[model samples]
Target: MNPFRHGLLAARTAAVMPHRQRQLATLSAEGNAPLSVLFYHRVADSHPNDWTIGCQRFRRQIDYCERYFELIDLAEMQLRMERGESRRPAVCLTFDDGYRDNSDFALPLLIQRRIPCTYFVCTANILNQTPFPHDEAAGQPLAVNSLEQIQAAADAGIEIGCHTKHHVDFSHVHDERTVRDEIIHAKSELENLIDRPVRYFAFPYGLPEHLTQVAVDAVIEAGFDGFCSGYGAYNLPGESPFHIRRFHGDPEMARFKNWLSFDSRKLRKNFSLDFRLPASRIPTLPVPTTMTPAFSVLG
Candidate 1:
């Protein structure tokens, strides 16, 4: 929010205004405008850190989204993708690491507004009432969400997803057994706590290098409806809907607007990882009770 950074963003916005219009026009005509999934970590006014955004700023962003975008959840986003191209751009809001501070304002606001969000939590932190390693390393050591809070969120209609047991970076994890334990067991533990089926999994430190074939394969084998990566990218139509791409929802409104506005440079940036899995390997998302699995490709 410094003046120089503000000026740079303004310059970028001016430069891309026309291009954004044309880009949206073309994509709208094509009927497959990209979907944006935004992720935030914490929402509070105290003990600020890289992962935290101020409550007022978070509210402003939500208001902006309410005005300019179609706010949907992951399941609805996937349903839209399945039905083929959509005419308008849509967004899904998600939070990572399950910080305790979100219960202060962010969660209550979303619940009151009836907005759809996926809240991903690391099981070990909640189970042990421990702080995230990153937060501890930053010397802030903020509180993490408790099991009761997570249950409350779920009961209020927020979708709780898994972020592994310990938030282990998959890039450094090579053993398949370890990956399976982290993912599958995490899902089971969360489900047990929430008493519902956990349908999604998000990779911790979700960059291309922070992900691995072993982890993604475990995600698929575990039958998660979809998986998410968090290195800031858009999820385009006609691509694999199962692999949800997300951008950072930091406090900077200019950057958030730029990313959602189809900034040409942002669109050109690629953040995909090649899992080399065949079509049959990727499982289909959940359907009605009468429906059966077709073993559709994950693409």
Candidate 2:
């Protein structure tokens, strides 16, 4: 990591993140106010990976989240926030990259549990049946979710969101035509596949530096209701046009809860905090479980 990134992470680690959770809990007891959008990539029973979690653990997380917060769809999340009507901290689950494993492994569990999810797909990669370029670089090529599976997800009531035509790097592209095409074409293609209006988008490599104002303009121009970034602070109620800030979740139960309950960066934009705050109680995280979800909204 570069010096700046390394330093920023160090600062976050030292911020006594657990204090934020206690604050959130106190606020919740008073009345639900905090809101967080959790981001995930893959859910497969595979070798250890930073981006993927096993199926059983994923199910456990869904169960825990359901118990803690009402799992509202992106539309409800925005509406509740825009109207200032949420009673408790809300949590939304999202996945990126449209991995076939998301369909083969994750989709079944979500379908069984009837949990709502927004899957941001790279249209070109799915159409072409290709691995994401990053996967190629790591010498671990993986399958992009196929249109058949994507359609099935939509059929099962999961929301379909855009991630660009080919997962283009918005930060590097200077051509206005490229940006427009990436945002517009991706939305159109996905809509055609799902036969529904694509309402949300997430910038490819959604860091501030990895994206430009031109890119943001294109998403708005293309008529998306909202968009998401790869990392950032949490979203409280009343924030509008719903630009979601997302963090990659950990597979380990304890580590992921630490992030869910107490990550210091939760309040900072893109996880950058200017003032130094002393650290606070780190709660014992819940153990992982293989139990199935208790209820399925779909059923």
Candidate 3:
């Protein structure tokens, strides 16, 4: 590791250790929050690459989640959170931009462990077998699963959600008609394929500032049960079902361990504080770099 990254990790460790231990003790006595945490774009493959985790490390994270949280499906999580119940801190797993490797790598492990999960798929990608622009720019091809494979996963009890038709940035799309088409078309395509009501949606590159009121209203009109975003935070009672937060996990074992030991409040505080800083005035920390691999390879 570079000196900068090593020092950042050490500092973060030092800064958060007491808080983590205290939180754990409090959790043990007072019990965990009914908070529902969502995770996205997980992979089980190799290291030194962005967006992919080695199988060993992936297994370890899953194991940790299974132990620490009640692993529930998204629907169950939504229902429980909506009811204001103080259930254990539960996690719902989701993958954005349906990838074939999700079927190839992660699905097998999830199946073996009987853990339920959801996949928010871009309908056009699967329909046309086209690579996402970002992946194409990176000289990487998307690995979206075929319709048959998606059906098989559904048969195995995985829930499929809509991730729009073309993975376009709805913010840049000035045409409300086009945005509505993207939202409605994707859900229709998935429902046709899965032969079930597709009730969930995940914004492509979801961020609060970027996702506008019109877009949110469009999704609600389309009859989605909820929507999720890439934001990193925990969901509390009465939080907007349309804009949920998710944590980004590094495929590296040490980084994953550090994340697990982290206090959620500290993470939230750091992000909020960082967002308020002038871009040029922001301090850089030495920590494991964020993974940027193709969403498809996240298996």
Candidate 2 accuracy as TM-score:
0.80
Per-residue accuracy of model 2 over 248-273 as CA lDDT, tens digit each: 66665555555666355446664432
Point to the candidate with the largest lDDT: 1
Best by TM-score: 1
Each candidate structure's TM-score, on Cα atoms with residue i matched to residue i, is 0.90, 0.80, 0.79
By TM-score, highest first, what's the ranking? 1, 2, 3
What is the Cα-based TM-score of model 3? Answer: 0.79
**Residue 272 C-alpha lDDT in model 1:** 51
lDDT of 3 by residue, 1-299 (tens): 68788778767666665666566455534534444454556374632246555667777777766766567666555554454453345567777887777777787888777787788888888888887766777777757778888889888877788889998787688688888888876788789978988877888877766566666767777777677777666655444434456656555445554555545654552233112211121112212111211111011
**Over 4 Å off in model 3, which ranges?**
1-18, 24-36, 42-49, 254-299
lDDT of 2: 0.70
For candidate 3, give the lDDT of residue 187. 82
lDDT of 2 at 185: 77
